[model samples]
Target: MKLYHSTASPYVRKVLMTAWECGLASRIELLPASGTPAAPNRDMAARNPLMKIPTLIRDDGSELYDSIVICEYFDSLAGGTLFPPAGEARWQVLRRHALVDGLLDSALAVRYETVARPEPLRWQEWIDGHSAKIDNALDALEREVDALPAAFQIDQIALVAALGYLDFRFASRPWRPGRPKLERWFARLSERESAKRTVPT
Candidate 1:
């Protein structure tokens, strides 16, 4: 398998981490790909209409896309327990995954608005709205830390990716102040070999 990879993309990191956890990292090859809304990788459109990173091209020449879908594919391929087979646990994991994705979406919105958009056209209100969403998500995670699964599932992998992105791209805005449980959880996960190897540059 080949993955359209971008080290700076937390979504890509999520897929890679999932692959590593599933013990399939050695079987996959990484193909460098980077882009923004202002300049997408046109070639990626052939494999993924949305032109997103973390696109996977299987050995059979078929493709899978976006982080979550690709991660689920990896888990299924490896018969990994990253996803619960069925029950409330599955829904809880999926719900947490959604929260992580929303946090990342808001973070990326803030990043693009501040870094990609011209200063004169930047909207503080839009940035503030997303920032609030990020904070709310962080608070939610902190509140639910005790309920977090002991097994490192898709949601936990995504949380690591999301928090790692905050550290990678928004270091100046520390998120560890009051969210001690979340911070500590991230710290433990960060020490994992998979997390260490996939750290964004």
Candidate 2:
């Protein structure tokens, strides 16, 4: 298996963390791809039509992309190890994963608005809209932050990654204020093996 991704991409980090948690990291070759969106690397586009980071090409020549799907696939490979087998726990994890995924999406939108688009064309309103979503999601996450388990489940993984990404891209934003529970949770997650290994630098 070959995994093509950038070193500092949070989305890619999600997949890498999944692979590491499942003990599948050794089976895949990690490759770096061109970061240009205008002329994304042909090899990546060949596997993922979207030319997205974190494209997984299996040993059989099959391809997979997108962090959410990739994480679910990894969960399956682990015999449903990362997720609850059934019932309300499954739904809670799914809900938290979905919320944190939204935070990642919003962060990307804000980053692209600033870094990809021309300055004159960049719309503060669009950035503000996405940022509001990220903020609200963080607030909701802080509410039940203590409920997270000590393992590397997808919800906790995605949530910590999402919070870490905010510091990476939006350092000036005040995300830790009024969220002591979430802050403590993130601090603890940072000590985990996967988090320590796959942190975006």
Candidate 3:
């Protein structure tokens, strides 16, 4: 299997972490794909219609796009380790994943709005909207993060990656305030081998 991945992408890190957690990291090849997102190379487009990073092309010529889907596939291949087996616990996990995913998306949008656009074209309003989502999501997660289990899963993986990305790209925004549990949780997750290996440069 070949994975079209970027070293600095949080979304891509989710899939990589999933593979590592599932003990399938060695089976896939990571390929660096360079191009503006608007005009990604044809090869990437072939694997993923969106021409996005973290696209997984399996040995059988099958492909999976999006980090969530890729993580699910990895967990399936590993006989269900990355996600919960079933029931309300599963829904909570999915909800946590969504929260982290939303935070990442918002952070990415704020980044592109600032760096990719001309100064005059920059939109603080748009940036603020997403930034607000990140803030509120952190607040919500911090409120209940302590209740979650200690073991790793896709939801926890994504939550940690999202918080790590904020520290990566938005250090100006401090989310550790009044959120001791969430901060401690993230601090612990940071010690994981997967996180140490995949930390954004």
Candidate 4:
């Protein structure tokens, strides 16, 4: 398998971390690809119409895009260790995954607004709205932290990936002030080999 990757992309890091957790990292090859929405890499656009990183090209020449899809594919290949197969546990995990993705969506919106947009075009209201979403998500995660599985899971991977991105891009706005549970949870997860291996540069 070949993966289009950007070292600093949290989404790509999520996929790679999933691969590592699934013990399939050695079976994949990473191809460097980096572009922003304003000027996308044509090479990557050809493979994925959305021009997103973490696009997976399987050995059969088929393609898969989006971090969640790629991560689930890797999990399936590893005999479904990362996801709960069925029952209420599955819905709980999926809900957490959605929350994490929503948090990331708001974060990336803030990034593009502040860094990609011209200063004159940047809107403080928009950034603040997204930042509030991030805060709310963090609060939710803190409340749910005690229920997190003992074993590493996909939601845990997603949470770690999102938090790592916040630390990477929004360091000026710290996230650990009142959320000690989440802060400590992130610290503990950071010790995992997959988390260490996929740290964004």
Candidate 5:
């Protein structure tokens, strides 16, 4: 398998962490790809029209994309351990995963507006809207931190990746100030070998 990856992408980190947890990390060959909205990676675009990082080329000449799909594929390959098979537990995990992914999406949008856009093109209203989304998501996650499982699953992995991205790009905002439980949970997860190895530079 081949993965088009970017170290700074939280979505890529989610896929990488999933691979590690599923014991499929060694099987993947990471191909560095840095793509932006204006300038996409040709190679990644060829495989995935969206030109997104974390695109996977399977050995059988098939392709999978986006972090969630790729992570679910990895889980399936590992005999389905990462996600709950059915019922309310499954919904909860999936819900949390979607929320964290949404948080990261909003964070990335704010990042692009503030850091990628030129000074005159930057829009304070846009940045503020996305920032508000991130703040609300963090508050929601903080409220549910006690319910977060200790096990390595898609929800937990996605949360960690989102938090890592916040630390990487928006450290000035300080996400841990009032979210003690979430902070402590992330602290423990940060010590894991998989998390340590995949920390964005």
Candidate 6:
């Protein structure tokens, strides 16, 4: 199996963490990718039409894109440890995963606007909107920190990945001011083998 990856991509980090937790990391080879919306890499486009990092090529020559799908695929290959199979537990995990993933999306948008766009072309309103989304999501996560599953599940993985991205790109706008619980949780999670190994370069 091959994984098209980027060290700075939170989405790619999530997939890499999933692979490590699922005990499939050793079976996969990482292929550094330079694909972006503004300038897509031909090699990555051939494997994933969306030209996204964290694209997976399975043993049978099939490809999988999107962090969530790739994580689920890894979970399946590991005999379903990362996700609950059914019922309310499954729903809760999925909901938290979605929320954190949304937060990551907003954070990435803010990053692109502030860092990638030309100074005159950048819109303050768009940046503010995305930052607000990230702030609200962090608040929600802080409030629900106690309720977060004790196990290192997909939800936890996604949340950590989102936080990692914020640290990587939005270091000037610290996220730990009022979210002590979430901050502590992240600190502890960061010590885990997967988190320690996959920290964005």
User: Tell me, what's the RMSD of every candidate?
Assistant: 0.7, 1.7, 1.5, 0.9, 1.0, 0.9
Candidate 3 off by > 4 Å = 35-42
lDDT of each: 0.94, 0.83, 0.85, 0.92, 0.89, 0.90
List, residue by residue over 1-201, the lDDT tens digit for candidate 1: 999999999999999999999999999999999889898899899999888898999999999987899999999999989999889999999999999999999999999999998999999999999999999999999999778879999999999999999999999988999999998899888999889989999
Question: What lDDT tens digits, residue by residue, belong to model 2 across residues 1-201?
Answer: 888888778888888888888888788798887565655677666689888888888788998878878888887887767887779888988898999998888888888888888899988899889989988898899887877765568988787678878888788886998999988888978887888888777
Task: Judging by TM-score against the true structure, name the best candidate.
Answer: 1
* Cα lDDT tens digits for candidate 4, 7-102: 889899899999999999999999999888887888876789998898999999899988989999999888967888888888898899999999
Number of the top lDDT candidate? 1
Error in Å for residue 117 of model 4: 0.5
**Candidate 4 Cα outliers beyond 4 Å, as residue runs:** none
lDDT of 3 by residue, 1-201 (tens): 999988878998898888888888899899997554545677777677788888888999899888899999988988976787788888888998998899888888888888766789898889889988988999999888888876688899898778888888878777788889888989988998878878876
**TM-score to native of every candidate shown:** 0.98, 0.92, 0.94, 0.97, 0.97, 0.97
lDDT of 6: 0.90
Q: What are the clashing pairs of model 4?
A: none
lDDT tens digits, residues 34-142, model 6?
Answer: 7556677777777888888889999999999889999999999889678998999899999999999999989888877877788899999998998898899999999
Clashes found in each candidate (C-alpha, N, C closer than 3 A): 0, 0, 0, 0, 0, 0
Clashing pairs in 1: none
Which of the two candidates, 1 or 2, achieves a greater TM-score against the reference? Answer: 1
Candidate 1: which stretches are off by over 4 Å? none
Q: List the residue pairs that clash in candidate 3.
A: none
In candidate 6, how many Å is residue 132 off?
Answer: 0.7
7: Cα error in model 1, Å: 0.4
The lowest-lDDT stretch of 10 consecutive residues in candidate 2 is 34-43
